[model samples]
Target: MYGKAAICLTFVILFLVSCSIYIGTVDLRSYFFPLLQSPPVLRSLCATGRPLRVYMYDLPRKFHVGMLDRRSSEEAAPVTMENLPPWPSSSGIKRQHSVEYWLMASLLYDGQDEDEREAVRVSDPEKADAFFVPFFSSLSFNTHGHNMTDPETEIDRQLQVELLEFLQQSKDYQRSGGRDHVIPMTHPNAFRFLREQLNASILIVVDFGRYPKTMSSLRKDVVAPYVHVVDSFTDDDPLDPYESRATLLFFRGNTVRKDEGKIRVKLAKILAGSDDVHYEKSVATPKNIKMSTEGMRSSKFCLHPAGDTPSSCRLFDAIVSHCVPVIVSDKIELPYEDEIDYTEFSIFFSMKEALEPGYLVNHLRQFPKSRWVQMWKLLKNISRHYEFQYPPKKEDAVNMLWRQIKHKLPGVQLAVHRSRRLKVPDWWRRKR
Candidate 1:
């Protein structure tokens, strides 16, 4: 009887020990498992702590920094990290389209710290996730011909021709048929001569107002913010921000424009004779830009009407100025939409609502002071994301753009793979 009791007691002890071990593992897993498996959004944003590997083509300086100084292009040697020229201060409004320059500079950066970088230069084309064609097409258009009608425009056309020939000869470009190639044509008319030929590649553009849906769309292309021309409003803190800003609404830029921008002419007429509003006809010049800086700093809302395209640099300028932006574009596609919520900091009006005789001003006149202050605070918080600079800071414009490019890679790979084995033409395109 004692032996039987001893065996039963041993069995009971063994069962309790096994149960304790199982419970301990569950408790540990509850705390530790979440650390190992991060959320999808976090994983996408962090990129598993790896910088995007990019392979940039060794193109001639004439296509990029050389445009800043003709002498650089005349040299036989290509542009190097040590010899890259600074963008000319006299570049004027062209500075807005300088996204291409900053992006190239980001790849050239050879800092000792790699943990904070969003992209790294890779020498081997085989290891590159995406290929960068560092042709400053926007600078080419701005430099070779300010006026498209001028005979000098032929120079821009010839450069596009030469670039196509160079790209077609490359085995890397041929392998993906240019699908993985990144080309910046932020200016609407950049690469005008041969844009259709590069429809397969990834385009970095400011807007799709001019592009056909077939050539460029959000599915494949990346929309980058224009480099803000106005100086950042560094000391924007105020005890009563809404009360400190005297002007109710402000707008100062070209009144005459094309397509959707015609609304500016109509708005100018309606906003005329208002005591609190400061709508004026002006062009972008050194003096005017400085005046605009002061005007935006003291205004409750900065108006951003569509320019030649659905968006313009003015919106980004407003952001940096810490002025609440009143956006009036109907079909604008903003940069970093997946990650940034524009509505948090900006007010939007449909073209119809903006054009109404008294709807816009009346709405602003009644906009809650508390809400405007909230938006102003948010604007200041997110403004750094729009800034473009060298040795790019964390979460700055250049790094944000690289993150955007990484997001598009999965879609890029899918299209590239489908094309390789497809025996028939794309059925989706045929139906369209």
Candidate 2:
């Protein structure tokens, strides 16, 4: 039986399909960004040339922080939140690619030494260019979105309702209807319950997998990184990556998944026990985390197949481990694509090309040793963009995310101005 959320989503899909006729008639891009034809020039508001002034809403702890609550020692199987060697623990979730942790960290970062930057967080909403709603939507979903059989058990519905009601009642939201607001929905299912209500706003997401293709566009959203979970193959580690690696290719993760992830089972059948190729199932338990990291570090290439969603943390892990990533997902949308050229350091294979007998392995083998080394070195250099840091460093993931958000300011501004001029009826606004 489908839950209410799923039923609502189905209705949304139908509504979007019917509305496509009207949407096609208008140039939607121009409606959102009037300055699309020309380059968007950034005018500095303060002495520092910060283009985007962000005002972060002080949401109650229950929305973001409360869900990460650890069990007390008196309770069974208590878990303490601690900063581990590779992945931080403040935002909960064991994986470094935790969108909840990363998104919150980015906005919360006060900056290194407080000087100048492209995106600056302002305490006053009156002085802000963009408003940030740091609700940790991804974490909320993960913690409460289970039990599809019961709608009451899902915390997302209530949280989304509260979030929308709060925002809608705000003076800022009333002015522009959240067009200039930024909300991180990095996980595919994050805020899925109220996606339509939030669609016009600036969204920070991983990919467009959850939305219908026609409705989801890169023009309105920022693609952000997965918090990488693997420990970096640093100089302190005794093993030399080039010499210690004996496996040509390795991948260990959920072999059984739905949607595009069906490819994993097929690939497993094709590559299992092949010479120098190691493919196995792995549970991401604490013990397995160590094993997975070691496996990737000891392999020349790591396979990145599409999961239920097009993107996965495995690709980021491979980058930090200095393993050349073999991407098999045709629909995968990467983060920071404009800033970083993935083709330089990673190998790509269309699903069709990868499935052609012996094609994938042979193509990877054709790369010369020197070329492979070049890719590995480049991965090491660019891997910093995928790293989330506290007090965000100059070139780290937090800074990179803000840069992406900065790119969206022109469009957001135009959208807000357009919406103000249109002045849709209150009934229509509530309906939407």
Best by lDDT: 1
Candidate 1 lDDT (Cα, 0 to 1)? 0.88
**What is candidate 1's lDDT per residue for 227-328, written digit by digit as tens?**
999999888888999999999999999989999999999999999889999999999999999999999999999999999999999999999999899999
Candidate 2 deviant stretches above 4 angstroms: 1-48, 70-97, 115-118, 150-152, 236-243, 424-432
Pairs of colliding residues, candidate 2: 96-227, 97-227
How close is every model to the real structure, measured as TM-score? 0.87, 0.79
List lDDT for all candidates, in order. 0.88, 0.73
The TM-score measured for candidate 2 stands at 0.79
What tens-digit string does per-residue lDDT give for candidate 2 at 122-202? 779899988888687876777774556566446778888999999999999878878888888877777877888888788
User: Over all chains combined, what TM-score does candidate 1 have?
Assistant: 0.87
Q: Which stretches of candidate 1 lie over 4 Å from their true place?
A: 1-48, 423-432
Compare the candidates by TM-score and give the number of the best one: 1
